[model samples]
Target: MYKTIIAVGLGGFIGSVLRYLVSRLTAGVDFASLPLGTLTVNVLGCFVLGLLTGLFERTGNLSPEFRLLLTTGLCGGFTTFSTFMGENFSMARNGQFMLMAAYLIISLALGFVLFFAGYAFSAKIRL
Candidate 1:
């Protein structure tokens, strides 16, 4: 428990710093009204989460502390909504119609549906 807490705290700190750096870099990159940092982080985070999940499943040696570090620490630090909005709008501006449409639909649809499913599953277990 102590290790998990420490791991999560460390991960959160690192994630917060990385998020700040991304925001700063994107701000300087004069690209109309779209945000690049948020989108990049979200996509990257999702990919890493997938990879980590697979790795954990395969290894089966991941401790609770490590899980906290990867899922709660790293991912928690990596995702950003402000950047997502900026990037999405930027895509719209650059006439990447398909990309923008796909991103918007997939992000929202998958996010909501997954959240609901997780919630429902937990509720069932509780009952």
Candidate 2:
């Protein structure tokens, strides 16, 4: 357990640093009102996670620790959007269309609502 945590923590640190650098590099880039830096990171993270998932599924030789370090730590720190997309992909692949749609709708709606709720709450505090 401790070893797993350490592996994830180290990977998270590396991934976060990389993310910051990427963001800085693309700070001024934008397309169609979207932040290109974030779009790049999220798409890259999703591709990496998908590639790793396919390889792992094929090989099944990697240790759980390494997997966690890459997926749950690195990809997670880079962008949780990858995880969300990956989950939806998996559900679709498994033919769970209804559940996938529900998850997609609920997550997006509730996430936006919670984000604004938090923002409004913070603004109200004004401290």
Tens-digit lDDT track for model 2 on 26-105?
A: 98875543345555566566656666665565566789999999888897788657656776788789898887786676
Model 2 pairs whose backbones collide: none
Query: Cα deviation of 92 in candidate 1 (Å)?
Result: 14
| 50-101: candidate 1 lDDT, tens digit per residue | 6565556556577888888878898888787766677678888989877788
Q: To one decimal, what is the Cα RMSD in angstroms of model 2 from the true structure?
A: 17.3
Off by over 4 Å in 2: 80-127
Q: Which stretches of candidate 1 lie above 4 Å from their native place?
A: 30-32, 81-103, 106-127
TM-score between model 2 and native: 0.61
In model 2, what is the error at residue 6, expressed in angstroms?
0.5
Q: Give the CA lDDT, 0 to 100, for residue 47 in model 2.
A: 57
